[model samples]
Target: MFVSDSAAVRRPRIQSRAEATILHADLDSFYASVEQRDQRWLRGKPVLVGGGVVLAASYEAKAFGVRTPMNVGQALRLCPHAVVVPPRMSAYAAASEAVFAVFHDTTPLVEGISIDEAFLDVGGLRRISGEPVEIAHRLRAEIATKVGLPISVGIAGTKFLAKVASADAKPDGLRLVEPGRELDFLHPLPVQRLWGVGKVTAAALHANGITRIGQLAELGEPHLRAILGPAAARHLFALAWARDPRRVETGRRRRSIGAQRALGRRGRAPEEIAAYLDGLTDRLGRRLRAADRSCRTVVLRLRFDDFSRATRSHTLLEATDATASIRHAARLLLDTAQPLVTERGLTLIGLSLTNLDDAGPRQLTLPLEPRAENTLDATLDDLRRRFGSTAVTRAALLKTGEGLSVPLLPD
Candidate 1:
């Protein structure tokens, strides 16, 4: 319901400082917005993506108290009239690529936080692109005109404050935090509004009768440290004072690649579970090789019927992108946790490849023998790239369909 494409909201402009050139641009309910954008009937209606695990919810659905990762049963109970749709990861990726194209055109310095949001440095762009707020408003307009999706933008002196301002301007709105008033804008928010403050940290702060950012600032670094250890206290206190020195950076690749599958409460056999793991490993290996990267650690994650979670991991002797190598380590980790899986009844299973490194050329042996699996990997990848992902599927996944291919930042 926000002014998605309206230029009227640009009134009452706030003064800008040289330091307030960072802009945080975020898509409004990215996946759900994509759905609504594509289907006219879904516009202004409660829509939910991923029935099993609420991947994304439209603003209309959120108004009914439907939060993502919530079970569909609870979400439906919250709003029985809400429409459910399966995820179209391909569509989301296409949209992301389009949006990123816009981002790159906007500024050379773009730090992508995810597929849907990024921080842009617009300090030097004042003469070319007008003020930071003007650039943000035009950026939103261009995206709406070109991509037919809503976005929110925030302008501030620091990355932390910029990101927080973006959240406040949801569903196609824009906000700017002027200099000298950063504390005035930041201190009134809840303690959890700080970057790294999660449920556990928030609970700790609440136990100490602190709920707002101003209270945390007034508590003093020494007292805050006593409440939340030294490292966390230092980080939160700095954030409380709106002190973040990070600048927008480009070409920063992810340190890890991961994917997860959510299964209904119905029990799954060990082989069936193994099949799911195989599909996940295959897809992840393909993604790693596609990104031209390698990983040295395989992590296995699980969520049980009781909603309890567990994680197991194995480190490899060397980094490799081969599906077989990654799957071997993943299977080993899963095998070690077999007892827990059996006891707890797994409802969700996931795999993460960590300790990632660029897949640079390696030294050849004296005989100059090449790995046959490497050729096989290249061949399969070529085929899939030429055709579609379904062109080459593992025999193990014939009965068990390939798990969902969720969208992610470039690998």
Candidate 2:
């Protein structure tokens, strides 16, 4: 395990530019940790959330080689004594909200990457908040005291390094990468530590004996471009030198809204796939409406049992956040991909609404007749909002006995 001193430490100055002000604060094993926090018996024990697939695994479970997105069967086989718990989304959301409240109080420039992680910029608060390390320590203490969760913080000069530092300080710790020691801290890590270095990219780099970030840096941009193409080569090369220039963007509008379901290794019938699509579309539509946004494009993504994937997309004439419209477009895309689905067994299906825009006040005109579909949509949305998401579901879903929609973090 990578370890760093919780107390601030200074290194030999290699660069004399800016102070390490960016902080990446990430909650440890968010969902599983929440389960352990609420239930006293679950403390210090391996915990798995979700039964069909692993949504989150505690550090204890992870020690047994269990991971998220793995099939529950495999996870259980690895850690048979692990406790399995269904997701409590409302409780998690409440905990997330409380933690974010603390983040906003610490700094106005907060960029939320997910429900459990954020990048906070605290550059100009020396007089008010002591120093970056001090601020991070207090933030971690506040969350533990108030929200009852353990969060690790990484302080660095750039967002990328800060994120990396926090990840290295896993399972409840704090790390600060001083400005000059960035390369000293980054170079020894594996190539997989770099962002965008997934399985395929790692394999490509490993084929050339470039397994470490320092090795890749020694290859230079030209050789990297020859191996990994221009765009990826340029990005990775710059990161090897710690040249991230992105800022923490506040109130960043989502570029797309998407949801995906894991179907395990079993073959799914067309109707079953459609039912899953319906659930995803309904949930996404509700989210779009809640955010006052509309989309012009619908995308369908599929993963086969052979570990290969394909994507299909459809663009509509007008932007819409209506569940019926989105579902219709999605169904059409699915129909076009039916041949491929049959040829290759599908293991996952996902839908995304892209080309988003602010859905300004829709023009209203008196209609000659009551539009039943529109009325039904309005009624269902209101009912779900008032009661719960399960207040009103489609007849098809009811007949199929499909499980409750799996909870997802906000897109």
Candidate 3:
């Protein structure tokens, strides 16, 4: 529909510092950086955050190929001299809040993608905030001083290029993709740099002798469609041609709440998988309740070692926010997708709830076995709210192993 908001319209040109608009901000080696900032001994050392797994790696560690979600054993093999630290999520949360405060200070139009990254639209602030490049410079200084960590930022005409620029400007750097230079900046990059073109997609592109953004851009839409499927081919072609038009939207309602974990390798028992699902369901349910939302559709996602992923979902007759209902539905979907889990092993599992509505008003009449007793749901929620999420517990969940249900953060 190509609808445009007249109020936020920006010129299609990149001018001096006073005229730039879109800005992409990213925290550099976020988790590990936080650890280093908090502990004096860790600075300038290769730091890996996590015990059995590598949740994040410092830039020093990354140079040795230590990456997130890889097992600790693998990370150690890659960076034998790395200093490992357990994750401090509460500290990270506080740091994220401070960084976001700096972002909001820059402008009101900020879109948060995650706790560590966001896009700020400062076009409308040109008259009030001087130059965009100067603003980014100030933002970097503010973060380094106040937050005690390094951050990188990118300024560009479009969100996609801004993100690309941010990636290119890593480890406490800033890069601006000047308007009219987007193609020059994007086309020479490897095809893997394109969003959604993971290892599987890249291999498929390579099989057809397509390895660079320029190559992908040269294949006309019809040729791309014939080689890849309609949807992916069309999207890849558009991205290859540097045609991303997504705007920096703020105040957009979140459509879903979800959590996922990489399982990696094979030989996992069904019980182990069930426990993982239980932990994810608990997190999703807490997020749903805290948001005061309920959903009818429960979706389960599974990824095979071969990189094939499958998703199954089922819609309930009535909306509910109870953990039991969400987990029950998720388990059903997991069971149905079991045939896809080969002996070779699995790589990832995820859970999401959609078709959301505000938590429905309590009904007078209900089935004998409803999702939950309204009185009980209320009591538990109040306790958790007044105390902490751990104030109330499910006996079954208490049996979870350390690695099986490591709590990343409270709801």
Highest lDDT: which candidate?
1
lDDT, candidates in the order shown:
0.88, 0.86, 0.79
Compute each candidate's TM-score over C-alphas.
0.92, 0.91, 0.85
Off by over 4 Å in 1: 1-18, 363-374
Give candidate 1's whole-model lDDT: 0.88
Better of 1 and 2 by lDDT: 1
**Residue pairs with backbone atoms closer than 3 Å in model 3 (clashes):** 17-131
Q: Count the backbone clashes (under 3 Å) in each candidate.
A: 0, 0, 1
lDDT string for model 2 (1-411, tens) is: 112233243323333237899999999999999999999899999999986889899999999999888888899999999999998888888899899999999999999888899999999889999899999999999999999999999999889899999999998999999877888899899999999999999999998888888777667777788789999999998888788888888988879878888777788899888888888888889888878788999999999989899999999887787889999999999999999988998998899999999888554445633324456667778899999888888777776443535434454
Instruction: Judging by TM-score against the true structure, name the best candidate.
Output: 1
- Weakest 10 consecutive residues of candidate 1 by summed lDDT: 1-10
lDDT by residue for model 1 (286-395), tens: 89999989898999999999989999999987778898899889888888999998998999999999999988876556576654454788888889889988888978
Better of 2 and 3 by lDDT: 2
The sequence of per-residue lDDT tens digits that candidate 3 reaches over residues 197-270 is 99888888888888888677766667777767899988887777667777788876577777787776756777
TM-score: which is higher, 1 or 3? 1
